[model samples]
Target chain A: MAENREFFNRRLHSLLGVFPIGLFLMQHLVVNHFATYSPEAFNNAAHFMENLPLRVFLEFVLIYIPLLFHAVYGVYIAFTAKNNLRRYGFFRNWMFMLQRATGIITLIFIVWHVWETRLAHAIYGTEVNFDMMATILESTFMFWFYVVGVVAAVFHFANGLWSFFVTWGITVTPRSQKVLTYATLGIFIIFTYMGIASLIAFAY
Target chain B: MAEDHKTIRMIVQRQDEPEAQPYEEEFEIPYRKNMNVISALMEIRRNPVNAKGEQTTPVYWDMGCLEEVCGACSMVINGKAMQSCTALIDQLEQPVRLEPMKTFPVMRDLAVDRSRMFDSLKKVKAWVPIDGTYDLGEGPRMPESKRQWAYELSKCMTCGVCLEACPNVNSNSDFIGPAALSQVRLFNSHPTGSYHKAERMDALLDDGGLQNCGNSQNCVQACPKGIPLTTSIAALNREATLHSFKSFFGSDYHH
Candidate 1:
């Protein structure tokens, strides 16, 4: 029973990283990318997402719950993981270390992000619009912080897809793994561009 | 450091006791045309003298057959975990460095206690279970294709090189490593060994089992036998996932 519990939990952790969490990252980046057009365009897009049916419930169940578990369990995994980059300096070994590093980074970034936008919206009734983000990013420190945070989050998800495939028995062959490495690197670049570009549009 | 044309310079990492601090002793030997690392170690043993010409205790290393088989000659050759018996001197860059694999407890100099791997074999029951007391004739026949694939897996000699290269198998983590995991896939596929398939899968599902694999993939590259370790691990991952589902929903769902 104990064995099965752990097996199920670890699989759940791996699954949650890709599903709503990864999918949500892509959607969130797209929503923010609207700022590249104009303030009104960004405001309209954010407003539409905010007014969705059962928005609060969906966020709580899908996003918050899974994020909480992934963060807590992921933190445990990160701290416990023994990184051996010195002895084994292979590409995948470096990725193993970076994966843990980025998991922690993404956690901190998400917490601060949620506190700034979502919690502020609830507490002060501040409108979650283009101006709010622009004002936040106006600070040089905050601008860089969001930039690093977005990049880290995107990297964690993209590189994690490679592990996801191998872990779940999807990419068994070395050739498949090699192919997926390039594919994930492409994902990282494309998503990172969308994310950083959105942040730049807001900041400047 | 200029290399002498006729001699090979080698640095050996030596530990006097299992719990003692390790130190390096350099030796310059008259290089033969076709000598390997094991033969070099034998030369050092014959002289038992360091580069300073000071007599030292004979360096300890385990070896058998003077070939890659028997898996006894596995050590870190020039910082790479591999069979020292087959490490030809001409192929290695000097000064050649030899060290005991850190994945296991060093019993002396180069000899390490590979009990963890042996224990994992027992945990997964990497064997064909049958009563030897009675005449059990004509075991279940396996096809030539299956035999060829199984023979590839059977080539593993528990060399410990895979564990040495695996970052996931370290001091803090108790990951069973890739060798035993591959053995599980090997045995589980056997005709008669399939009876205890659930038992082996359960062992892999336990702590320090499949969940601990970070999939850094160094094991496949470091394996001396060219075993498809990552492929076996990935296949087991699929099997483990299905095993959990079957257990959770009850076996009746399979029909």
Candidate 2:
């Protein structure tokens, strides 16, 4: 029974990635796409998300809790796992290494982004608005940082989705996994487009 | 006279005690025709002298079946995990470095505690069940095609080198590594062993079982017997998935 905990924890990690976290990531891309449509729509969606009843409770339950668990456990996995890329230069091995690397970079970027926006509002009484986002996006350094961050986050989710299927026994056969790989690649392309488009909207 | 002066240089990682820090000791032994790493180590055991000619404690390593059958002599030779008994001196580069498999805890010099692997084997029940000592007339026969692949799986010697090469089988993670996982395929495929197939599947349904593998593909290359460890893992994943579905909807659903 004690031995079973490791299996469950890993499954849970995979589950959380696709469900609340992956779903949230997709919805975030969609909301940012609203910026491509119009800033008013983007701000309105953001306002609705921020002002939802039990907003703090929802954030705690949905966003913060899952993100905390995934990020912390991911960091633990990254530190524990070894990489032998020199000997095994296979594509999957490199993907495995990239997954961990992107996970770490995404974690740092997420923390900084959250602090700059949400935490700043909470701790310093700063208002979050289109001007603020536009100003940050306009900065050359911050612009490049977000670009890298968005790429890392999207790639991690897309690749993670592929791994999650195998880890949870969802797609066991190589053929099925190959199909899912295409699907994940599509997700990567679509999400990346949405993310970059939103960032471009902020610049303009 | 110059031919008689040939020597092989070796650098071995040694530890005096289990709790002691590991240190490197270099040795140069008179080159002999067709000498393997084990032969070189035996010479060092005989001489107990470093390359600098200083007296030292005899180097310790585990070995059985010098032909690499028992897998008792596996260690890292020049950054590759393999059976030392089969590692020929002629094929190796100079200053052949020998170190104990790091995946397992060091017991002493070139000896490690492989109990974790055996324990995982037990957990996965890598065996055929026997009800009694009495012989039953004519056990069920396996198809030749199936038997062929099963024979491939049976070649595993529990060498612990696969675990040594694996990145997930580190100190921090409880991953059972690849060898035992492959054994799961081995035992589950046996005619009589298939009777307890569900139980074996259940054993691997836990943390260290299948989930810990990050798909690094090192174990497949590191396996000295050339067993298809990853292929076994993939097959088991399919089996385990079916098992989970059966368990969820209750056994009456399907076989």
Candidate 3:
């Protein structure tokens, strides 16, 4: 009885990850990638997102609630997870450890990130545009912090996608699983590049 | 064939009592061609002498059928859990290390209590339910194609290898492990077993059930029977997911 709840909660965690959480991450990176153009271009893109109708309500329903659940349940999972990579050092074994590790890293990063940007917008009325990001990344230490945070976030998402397919029964066979591994690796590389490139544009 | 190469050095992990601390004992055996790990152990048993010029109690292990089918003689040989019956001396590295599977309680040296796996099997009801009282009308037949793959799952000998390989099934956690999870899929897929599929699924939905899998994927690779364990897990994941939805939003479904 209670186990079913656990099962549902776990599946919900997995589903929420790829659906709203993972989707929002990709969208966020693409929007930030606009920085590669010019300040006006990036500002225009950021402003366009900010001006969306019912933005606050949509953010709560689609982003904050789901992200909160994923993060909370993810922490429970990470705390309870036991790693055995020393004896069973298989590829997937390493991946399992990394997933948990990056989840923690991503959670810390997201909390600080929300405080710096979105929450700043709400509390201090700071504009979430190019200048704000430029100042955030201007510091050498903060720039490296963003680099670690961004890479961890992307890796967590990409690896989480592979298990998402399995958890949802999308790719069940070895051949299908192998194919998705390569596909997810591509996703990791592409997302990581976009995230780091945008940061570089802001810093330099 | 080379001269002066007729010996095999082995380091065996020994525990005198169930609660005793495990210790190592080295033995030098007269190696022979086609010698499997079991035969080597038997030699050591016949003469329980240690390399330090001391007499000791014979090492104890579990074995039957002397074939992989029985799955009784499983141990961690050279850091990998496998059937000692087929572990040929020639294939193993010198000074071969042997240890009991740590996932379960070490009953004695190189033999741990596998009752945990059996308990899991019992919990999941890994059997088709049928009463002899009445003829349940012709059960639905399965396709030959599906049977072909299902046969792979039936090969599980319950040797406890999968659990040994899984990090999730340790002293602290009651994960039920991949062995029983795969068994649930096997029985549930059967025409007769499908009669009680809901019951088995409920058992799986309980704590220490399917949600414990972290997808380490070592079970499928470690299974001596070559069972597609991860595939079974994935299929069950889908089944559990649908079951959750039905239980939540659909008709009041109950056991």
Candidate 1 stretches greater than 4 Å from native? B1-5, B132-134, B252-255
> Candidate 1 lDDT, tens digit per residue, A1-204?
664566667888899999989999999999999999999999999889999999999999879999999999888778767776776788888898999999999999999999999999899998899999999999999999998899999999999999999889888888999999999999999999999999999999
Residue A125 accuracy (lDDT) in model 3: 96
Q: Model 1: how far is A154 from its true place, Å?
A: 0.9
TM-score of predicted chain A against the true chain A, for each candidate: 0.98, 0.95, 0.98
Compute DockQ for each candidate against the true complex.
0.67, 0.43, 0.57
lDDT of 1 at A44: 93
Q: Candidate 3 lDDT (Cα, whole model)?
A: 0.90
Candidate 2 regions off by >4 Å? A1-3, A34-65, A82-91, A118-130, A170-190, B1-4, B133-136, B251-255
Task: Give interface RMSD (Å), model 3.
Answer: 1.7
Whole-model lDDT values for every prediction: 0.90, 0.87, 0.90
Which candidate achieves the best TM-score against the true structure?
Answer: 1
Over all chains combined, what TM-score does candidate 1 have? 0.94
Ranking by TM-score: 1, 3, 2
Compared with the true structure, model 2 gives a TM-score of 0.85
Model 3 over residues B94-158: C-alpha lDDT tens digits?
Answer: 89999999878999998888998889999999998666788877778899998997899999999
State each model's C-alpha RMSD to the native.
Answer: 2.4, 3.6, 2.2
